[model samples]
Target: MTFAATVLTLYPEMFPGPLGVSLAGRALSEGAWSLDTVQIRDFATDRHRTVDDTPAGGGAGMVLKPDILAAAIDHAREKQPAAPVLAMTPRGAPITQARIRELAAGPGVTLLCGRFEGFDERIFAGREVEEVSLADIVLSGGEPAALAILDACIRLLPGVMGAASSGIEESFEEGLLEYPHYTRPPEWEGRTIPEVLRSGDHAKIAAWRKQRSEDDTRLRRPDLWERRGGARAQSASGARHEDRDQGQ
Candidate 1:
């Protein structure tokens, strides 16, 4: 089945931007996935089409009106009821590669792109929306995060990547950072490809790759290494949940 994606945002035109190029673009053209954008402002009831208002507790930035956001989410649900609704927020759980893989395997997904000071708190509980965070940093808006998320998901769809295993060994798939890669020139700046890689010994190469992945994860992303139970529980799989700070 096609992995359908519906995005609810104030800037509907921002979508299919970078997503319209490269692998994602190719997948979209081939019908491996689909995109639908919803303009949250379209559900506004005011003459000015206002979708945000002053923060309830007297904050500096305005907050998206819950009613307008609810309306837009409901509309998206009507069209794609099987899809899960995710609100992009800094206050949400950090997104992971495992989560992206799950979404790619599902019927589809609905993304709520927050703007201004972000969504009203009530909308999350009342609408049953799942909060998702791209990273620790903040952005001007959720559109960029949404685009990145969609790209990550789209590239995993069947037939999107040239090789089925193209994504399987990448970082996070096995709770470890990916092994370093090297290619011809064989020698660059006095550096040569690892001898084992050129030895034509598949077994040795695999062993080297696994060792590199573990060592790098332990060194570069100790957090991920720890989450997988550190060296003691190296067999652990999948992602672990972590708290997120608020972002755009």
Candidate 2:
């Protein structure tokens, strides 16, 4: 099934931006997925096509009008009934790779791009939209984030990637960051590729990769390690082994 993505944003031209290049662009051209952009302002009732208004009760910035956004969402949904409507905002739950995989496996997704101060609170509740955040950091607008999200999903579509294992072996697929990779010249600036990788024994190579994955995750992303119970879950013997390996 082709993964269809509909983006509701004030800036429709910004899309298929980066998505129209690289692996995502190839997938789009191959019909592995599709992109549809909806102009939120198109749903406005006024002559000025206003889609935002001053925040209720007083705020520094304007809030996206609920009625206009609701109309745009409803219009998008009419065409993609099975797709989930997701609103991108800083206040939303942080998006995960698992969620991206889920969306890629589905029929499609509808992304709501917030602007001005952000979407009015009522739009979420009234429209039953799911809120997703790219990270803790905020952006000038949601178009960039929406583009990133769609690119992620498109790459996971079947046959989009050259090798099926390319997606499976990468970071976050197994709850740990992927192991470091090296290619020839074999030696770069006096830094040689790990000898085990050149030994031509798949078993040893796999073990080294797994060890590096664990060590890197432990040091660089302790939060992900903790989430995987890497601290408490690792056996006492395993820790001793790791110490010995590191000391080598």
Candidate 3:
């Protein structure tokens, strides 16, 4: 099935920006997935197409008008009823690989990009919108976040990647950071591709990768390591004696 991603934003031109190049772009051209954009201003009924107004309680920036956004939501749903609507805002829950996989496995998503201050709280109560954040840091607007999300989803679409198992081996799939990778010159600037990867022994390579993933995660993202029940899980399975470090 072709995945469909619909983004509703003030800046429609920003879309398919990064998503228009590389794997996502290629898949988009090939129809592995589709990108549709809705300009929020188009839903405004006034001459100026004003979609935002001063904050209700008197804040620094304007809040997206509930009625205007509501209209946009209704319009988007009319076109794709079942797809979940996501509002990109810093106040939203963090985006996760698991969530991205779920979206990639489904029909697609309707991303609502917020600007200025953010959506009027009433909009959330009135619409079944799921708010999501790309990261902790703030951006000028949600278009960048939407683009990142679409790119992540698009790359996971079937046939978009050359290797089917590639998706499964990536970081966060097993709650571990991805292992280090090496390629090309085999030796570069005095550094060599890990000898095990070059040993032509698939078993050793797999063991090496698993260990690397465990070690890397423990060293870098101790949060992810522990969250995945790192020590407990590892203990449950018992250490892979074969995974013992070997310069060989």
Candidate 4:
């Protein structure tokens, strides 16, 4: 089945921008996935195409009009029924690799790219929308974040990537960061590829990569290492280290 993705945004042209250039683009062209954009402003009921309004009580930035946003979401649903709706917001759950993998395995997604200060709380309350944030920091708008999310999902679709192992060994896939990769010249400016990788013994190479992935994760992303049941993984990695030493 061709995965279907619909994006609702004030700036519809911004879409299929970066997504049209890489693996996402290739998948899109190959019918592995499809994309369509809905202009939120098109749902406005005013001459000026106003989609936002002043804050209810007192706030510096304007809020997206609830009615207008609801209409846009409804329109998106018409085209891609059953697709889960996600609103890009700074005050949402951070987007994670697991979430991307889940979405990639599903039919598709309907993304609502929020702008201005944000949508009226009613938009979320009245609709079954999942709030997703790219990071802890804020952005000028949700479009960029949405693009990133789509790109991530697109790359995970079957056959989109050249190597299946590429997906399996990435950071967060095994509760550890990926080991360093080296290529070409075998020698750089005073640097060279690790000897084990050059040794051509698959077992030893795998063991080296495993230990590096564990150590790097523990050092660079202690937060992830801790969250993903790090102790068990560390123990497993330690066992392997011992086995490698015994074989040596």
Candidate 5:
């Protein structure tokens, strides 16, 4: 089955351009995935198709009206009933590679991109709504965050990527950063690829990669390493979890 994504936004044209040019584009072209944009403006009741309003309390910018956004969300739900509706916001859980993997395993997803200042708080108080964030930083709107999540999720879908192990070996897959990679020209500008990589020994190459990953994670993202008791222990525990789950 094709993985689907429904995006609710004010500017519908901004998408399927950047999104249509990358791996997500390839997935769409190959029928591995599909994306649908629901314009909130279309659901507006006013003659001018207005979707935003001044905040309930005094505020610096206009907030999106819940009625218009709710209508847009309802339209998206009708299109993809099984998809989870997600609202992109700064206050939500941080998006991680592990979370992307989990999302990829689902039927599909619907993204609500709030514009102007933000959405009315009532939108989030609903029973089925979920809010997700890309990072700690704020953005002009949620469109970019929606695209980011869509790209990550599409790559993990079956047949979208060239190899299943490719996504698994990427950064954060094993709770460690990815190892460095070198290509072509054995010697370039007096620099050479690591000797272990050129040796043609698979076992040695695997060990080198593992060690480099550990070093990279320890040096760059020590926080991740610390949470898992360093790289080796984390890898071992992850393997055990997989083994136990598989045996069940």
Candidate 6:
């Protein structure tokens, strides 16, 4: 299982430092995954390593030359033919846990980080690239967004986490938020840990966790609840069908 990522950017040095310190870092060192950075400037034509130019129609910042970026991506694709080329931009689809899971389950991926005024729109129009965004706000560059995505996907790889179920139990796995957690020193500042947690009764703890998760979702993100109505309906229908079969 070779999980690899290629990042296209002028600032290749920005990576590996942050990505090198965590689970992703360990994965790279242990050969479970790989990350390669391609300097877009290396593909420039001029003597000065010029990868950006003035916009065709006049703009505030220089635009990344499409040909240069394209060459960089092509080079990476040649090395890893199975990698998916993704461009980071505020105009792209919103990144979510589901998307991260989808990417992690794939062979590999390539991240294109844009700088200056951003890449020529033609790159997005012509290339087979998926545009992704971290949030509604804009960042100085795509490096941060690319790193954010890399971190999310790498941790989901098998063996990267200590427990396989840790990823599933995390928030958004069940269409509801996760229940609150408590640690040692059951009593703190006049507050006591929930009795269900300390009861040592597994069945009661499980029920309490489920109910708390639902309640947290309702309070924090009611939008997930609205979207989950279809799933809930399907579950009800399945239960009714099973009941009828048992009666027969």
Work out candidate 6's RMSD over C-alphas: 3.3
Candidate 5, poorest ten consecutive residues by summed lDDT: 123-132
Clashing pairs in 3: none
lDDT of 1 at 216: 94
Candidate 2 segments exceeding 4 Å error: 230-248
Q: Residues 119-158, candidate 3, lDDT per residue (tens digit)?
A: 8999999999999999898998999999888888888888
RMSD, each candidate, Å? 7.7, 6.8, 6.8, 6.2, 4.0, 3.3
The parts of candidate 3 lying over 4 Å away from their true place are 230-248
Write one digit per residue (lDDT tens) for candidate 5, span 198-237: 9999999999999999898889988988975755787898
TM-score of 2: 0.92
Off by over 4 Å in 6: 230-248
Query: For model 6, how many clashes?
Result: 0
**At residue 99, what lDDT does model 2 achieve?**
94
lDDT per model vs. reference: 0.91, 0.91, 0.90, 0.90, 0.86, 0.88
- TM-scores for every predicted model: 0.92, 0.92, 0.90, 0.90, 0.89, 0.89
Where model 4 places Cα greater than 4 Å from the true spot, the runs are: 230-248
Candidate 6, residues 44-126, lDDT tens digits: the string is: 98899998889897758898888988888889889988878989989899888998898899987899998888888888776
lDDT of 4 by residue, 104-196 (tens): 988999999988899899888999999999999899999999899998888988999999988898887877899999998999998999999
Residues 83-187 of candidate 2 have per-residue lDDT tens digits of: 999999999999899999999999999999998799889887898699999999999999888988888888888998899999899888888999999999999
Structure candidate 1, residue pairs in collision: 90-245, 90-247
Better of 3 and 5 by TM-score: 3
Model 3 weakest lDDT span, ten residues long = 239-248
Clashes of 4: 0
For candidate 4, give the lDDT of residue 166. Answer: 82
Instruction: Locate the minimum summed-lDDT window of 10 residues in model 2.
Output: 228-237
